[model samples]
Target: MNPQSADAGDRTTGRYKQKREAILNAAARLFDENGIKGTMLSEVAQQVGLSTNSITYYFKKKEDLVFECLMHTTSTISAIAAESAAGATPEERVTRFVTGRWKKLAEAAEGQYPAMMSFRDVGELDASYTKTIFSAYGDMFRRVRGLLAQGPVTSDNRMSLTIRTHLLLTSTQWTRTWLSNFSVTDYGRLAAYMCDVLINGLLAPGKPWAPTALDEKVAAIKLPEPSNRNFIAAAISLLNEVGYNGASIDRISARLSVTKGSFYHHIPSKDDLFAECVSRTLAVVEGMQAAAIAGEGSGGDKLAALARSLVGFHFSPRGPLLRMTAWTELSNLEQFYGQVQPMRQLTQTVVDFLATGMMDGSVRPTHQAIAAWMVVGAINGSATLDKWVPGSEKTDAVELYLKPFFCGICSE
Candidate 1:
């Protein structure tokens, strides 16, 4: 081999590699800023100071290049998740895990992938492109699930912990992706706070499980109580599928396959029914928390049980009522505060746990107001994200994401 020819060949290879990287970066920025369908190969090539023909030489199809760009972004996120996992303490790992992904989203917000929010939203429409993105976050998902399933280091497990973990991650990320109406700082802070609540609940003292109690009560009493009180269950379905204003007595009656007269017997009027639905849903949540508080367990166990109950119940079919409650609380500010005190009380239990934990040495010093709101937001985000992710097997996708944030704020 001639030494001069070898050096020239090496230089040629290096230049080609650099150009390819440049093209991929440009494509990602474009995709994150514009929808994948909105971006063009010519635009990508032009952005990178390359001719269309030159880009074609590297990537035959525009989509092939788009897929690569998505993959590149995913890879960056994967590296961050890995780094977070490798960090010294759970708290440091969580902060890095969260902040690192936030930085990635901020960077991409100016591009095409960010525009789409997440690959799962459009993966079915373009499988190859989404696959590349999914590959990047798969590891993070596994790590998150593993953490939640093990029973928190500070809490107890009352439900399917693995399922809850998956729900938490799915919902939190989806919220950040879809609800851009909220600021990024608020979303991130909210996610971190919710995770802390779950962690505190798991490790705190008490029997935090709910389904078990329902089972025991049913067994002992032998009474067939309504899984839901009266027509409240049917009313919730209508409210979720349609907005609160759209759901009327006629609609509820129709959904129940009963006459309006039959529905009237359950409640006084449409207004009463809507209020009842919200109250009943909150009652279930509060009931779970109450059970956790009263049960025999450590503080950590009580907290985890309450956390699991909150997340699990929220994902249940009736869970949409929680959103309805929030909407009502915000929209009818005059009436919501008075009518929704019981629901807010469930939230107070969470706030109380954090305040109690901080003072007792279970949780680090943190503001109850800030921490409580963060958990609430993350739970909301988790619900929003699950709707957009494609082929997501998770029913309770927010659990894992919430757990780490929960763990991050704990004493240990």
Candidate 2:
């Protein structure tokens, strides 16, 4: 009741807030690395020098913590999109929005702010929090979509703008995967180059989006198809939906209308199931790559073919390749290291393909490694296409989805 006592209470409250923020920061980084389902409250507490019970004082449960983290990220992004809407034109709005985001990203990477988590794992959160998170996310998405519209929406241009909205946002999110390769100071340049790519596209002027077919080579790849009534087939679909940790043996078995014994009979363990899924996903990815390279076409044509194959496969009945984020759930450092090597090698393969395009003058002369990674991110991030463009799974992937990447977002 005394003035000194009130002053002391203020100091304690400030410290509590600081400590709570510290936990949130640590939890966000862990969620970025290991996903929400894979992160632990104890790990977060350990990062902040607090006991697990102490964390409960701030957040009642893991979902509460995760929901707050996700809401923070969505709100931050929505603010960016809203600020960018001040630009005079759609293209200006896009450039301003993207550059603003990258600057913040650079600041965060250099410890200017707490790290932000991606929405890739938001679908895996507890049911109680999903509705609110989805509402926030939908608001954020509509604001981004606002940047691409200046006139009344029509049936013809609605889908085009919707897909572009997804592509632009997904490409921004994809930066998290490749932004570490450069010095933080270089992010400004990277952001400009990315805007250039999105606005002008990778192809040299006047190039068309014609792609060589990958069907024959894809058929010869001899991997499990998505439409099949098999274990791996059902597992891949389930993994794509709920993420790695959320895709349990029971869920997979029940999806296939089988028993847990049958799951054990076909797959030895959960890790083994994930390993097999990863192996198959890489196979399909590599097979598509090889198919594109082997096709009769220019470098740009091959790149188009590759992008179409990967994106189309995802949105098609043959698709839904294990969402690449699922690969991050392998906690065993040994298995993680061993399994990730091929994927790393595959990324280099994409760089090489981009180099080939540049050499033949089919593609523009830009940063190859960055371009390669962007293409990879574009494909991997398309798993959310259904949410962005309702009924996107049944649409022509090349036209509505991959076109904006191959041709500029501002293309006619």
Number of the top-ranking candidate, with TM-score as the measure: 2
TM-score of 2: 0.90
Please write out the lDDT profile of model 2 over residues 283-392, one tens digit for every residue: 87877777776767777877777777777777666666777666665577466677667677767777877798899988998888888888878877687677557877
Q: In model 1, which regions exceed 4 Å deviation?
A: 1-230, 246-250, 260-268, 286-297, 310-326, 329-333, 358-370, 374-412
Question: lDDT per residue, candidate 1, 1-412, as tens digits?
Answer: 1112123444468676676666776776565445455567888888988888777777777767766565555566557666766655544555566566666665445442332133422442355455545655565555654433333433244234433444445434444423454565565665565445444433334322333443332122221235445477666655544345446677778878889887766677876766666666566655666676667543444455565555555555535434422233123455656666665665577677666666666555555765555555455544333443433225333344445445533232
Question: Clashes in each model (backbone N, CA, C under 3 Å)?
Answer: 53, 0
Clashing pairs in 2: none
- Model 1 residue 392 distance off true place after TM-score fit, in angstroms: 10
Model 1, position 189, has a per-residue lDDT of 68
